[model samples]
Target: MLRRANAIAIFHAIRLQPGISQREIGDRTGIDKSTVSAVINQFDALGLLERVADESRKGRGRPSEGVRINGAAGLMLGIDIEPERLVVMSAGLDGVPLDVSEYPALPSESEFAGGVSAAVAAHLARGGSTLAEVRSIGVCLPGLVDRSGKLISSSNFRWGAVDVAGELRARFGQKVWVDNDARGAGLAERLFGCCLDVQDFVFIDSHSGVGGALYLEGAIYAGSLGIAGEIGHTKIVPHGRICQCGDGGCLSAYISGPALRDAFRGAGLVANSFAEMKALAEQNIPEAMGVLDEAGEILGLALSNFINLLNPPNIVIGGGLAVLAPYLMPPAERVLRRHALPEGLAHCTILISELSKEPHARGPLAVALQGLSQLNADGAFPW
Candidate 1:
């Protein structure tokens, strides 16, 4: 286990800085040279790292060598199941994607499951890799995922009590792990996003629906039943609008993609997607701007409550609506400052997610890599 920790640290450094030297890995990771060497040897045995000599160096001196993660060592498969689409990606240990595929999400449960399997197969074929080479598969669901990896409910996808992990494992004959999409994205943000510097943070994703996760001390607080970070359900407005969750004035009802589209429709603005809404707003459409501003303010008020309770140093907003941060964040910030405690509000920074463009795709890749790191010889991830 200690060797595993050392390998993870070294591998993480190599992932961050390709062509980094052994000495530099030790300097950056604070692992001693001997321990670094030992761990690197272990990784070499596992086919996870390789040393490449600097061929451009001057003739007389010994050639300097640098290390990089062996891209072909193993692959992680990331599958993100959305209401409208199923996105898949094959990524290396360094988080560099080799292939990606997308398919329309079918309403039939069996067909959707088959589509996911076929997508993975096609992605692997494009990359010339196989199921045998995949280290693990991470499935992202937009619902309440329990400790046993069962999705209890999902209004967007209309799923209930599905053994997601078990199904994937049975299909692929490989390790499978499952989690809420928001929480999976939060894990990615911690490892590869702005939260690297701030351990205590909240990641809110405003996709087709709204969801979020809380990270404290560099790990997610999954709560007792793994439903802790469902921030979108928190009531914001008193009896304003009906939410899909059978509640009134939930934050998701005001800030999600469906909500924004609903607001646009009510105002006589035709926007089928968030992109069109953004375009309308950029064209100086008053109704479009109003819709976004109102949503932002509602999000800020909801987040202010989160701040009062969690006191996180950073709050990252991602997913489709993140593109509207320019129009949305100022009003949201204003509301946050007005409602949140002075000390916490002063310290917190609200920023758009760096992984906003394809968070759903990158998130599951990150999760698969994490599960790969935690696996035992029997292909089980021990929490």
Candidate 2:
């Protein structure tokens, strides 16, 4: 299984850079030349890899062969159901997104699933690839998702109950993976983000709600019931304001972007959305700045407490509210430094995630990829 994993890693590397030579693959992958040769040869024999004769470096002792991934080997699918729309993407085993599509967010859970199925079918009809080619499907969702890919609830959609995993599996007839939006973003950062070099970090989303995903010792900590990083639900003011979760004083009650927008309106400002808040902030509107400042303060307090408790190496802030980092970072840092234990506070660093796609949605795609590798308990990447 370890050897197979190495081979899959090498294959994925070559897939990342098509037409790569064996020496280059080995050099980049840190795998031995003989191992690379054996893996390549084995893959060739299986018809899952294609090698092309190369004459470009003919003068260098001996010629080398360029290798490319067999697109037909398999495909992976990612589905993200946000508040406003459903997003779908198709990628190769290499994790390169080949296609993307979106549709109405849906008025109900069943409607959401129905929209996703239709969107996926539409993408497949484009002629590049079909649903029959998909080996695994990962879903990014807005709720507490179990390790088994079941959704506990969705605050945004107000979904009280739903068997999302079963529905998706039944519809697709393929392996299905489900994960919380923040958790999925953490995976995206872990797999491909600035935090790649750092372990034990937190990934936060600062949008409609303040949520995060925790990575401990280089692996995500989903906690019991997969609610590990539900930071937004943590009580902040101890009774300051009523929250959507039927609780008051939650961090999300005061710090989420949407909450900030509401506060702006209460302050005699008329900002209905995060975009308006951003524009208002740019105009140096005192009300807008005040809302962000308060949010930063709460966020800072949350981080300070989090830093003391977890002692993570880095605190990466992402999501839409990250746009406000520049304006709010100072106050946020002030609160963090003021509240955290000196040593732990000083030791931790804060950053923002830099992913093109919505991280919450992309997270499940990563779960699907991992599930593809673990279709069997033997612990191997499917090739």
Candidate 3:
């Protein structure tokens, strides 16, 4: 029981500060000195935690100094499959990205899942640890994931009714969770980003197609069918172009950059790629500015309704398109001024993810941390 208390206290200490000495940990957690040492040893042996030399004393340490949760000792693999690329990354208890690998676009889930499995296998073969060290695999795909972690449907992938988590369990002999990419990204944000203290908020992902995730009172609020935050398919026009999902007049008709590119091809001011458009936004091109205005307007209109219903104090936008915030954000604020309640919008802090990479980059570490949460004082979850 004391070890259990230490386990809980250790996590609390890490949550407050990612890297702290064992002595400091004992001090903060109020665990007895000898007991803390024993529990830390058990955690280390089980591959649930790692110890690292603190940055301050790079190559130097006292006899019992510089120990941290060994992030690389245990592995959490995260996968994100997009239309143009499949990204697989690993994070350890060190709480830093250990490795990332990618493959060119795949046309099917079998292809994507194969690359994912291969990546996980190769990463484990890197001498980081044996396969036994990996605790779980977390997959973030662009679709609705049922409670059982099955893919119900995806607008972009054309994947339907696949039992992803169960299949993974059968093949890998490891715990696996299938979650909507946007929502999984939001989970990372809640645990590690600016929203750590905000219990109520919305996380919006401005990707090739816009998506969102909702958090109510500090937990993921998956809707009745687990398809909440699928804001992209909502119709914003009466007879606009049809989306890949076979829906008509959806917001994808107007705001999606792909739709914009298809409409304004050969406009002579924009390039044909999202990356190039981002460069143009950086360049402050007038045409680029115009495109963001329309996109932001749609996003803001959708958000205004959400704010009225939820009244969250924060709205975090992450993903590729958010880089155009300077050009796009104003129109969103303007649209909200005319629609949302003044009280709902008052204290809202619209912030961008400050992480160097997109939210997907943080997904693996989030799962690694969740896996760590499973360990009891005995330093193992029941088989």
On lDDT, the leading prediction is 1
Model 3 RMSD to the real structure?
A: 5.5
* Per-prediction backbone clash count: 0, 2, 9
Question: Which parts of model 2 have CA positions greater than 4 angstroms off?
Answer: 1-74, 126-128, 356-361, 375-383
Tens digit per residue, CA lDDT, model 2, 95-183 = 66777877677678766667778888887787477777887788887777776667788776688667777787789864777777778
Candidate 1 on 195-294: residue-level lDDT in tens? 6666688889877678998887546778888788998888888897988777888888888888888999999999877678889989998988898888
Mark the 10 consecutive residues where model 3 has the least summed lDDT. Answer: 374-383
Taken over the whole model, the C-alpha lDDT of each candidate is: 0.78, 0.74, 0.67
The lDDT ranking, best first, is 1, 2, 3
Error (Å) of candidate 1 at residue 35 is 6.8
Report how far off residue 194 is in candidate 3 (Å).
2.1
- Supply candidate 1's per-residue lDDT for 294: 88
Assess every candidate by TM-score.
Answer: 0.88, 0.82, 0.79
lDDT score, candidate 3: 0.67
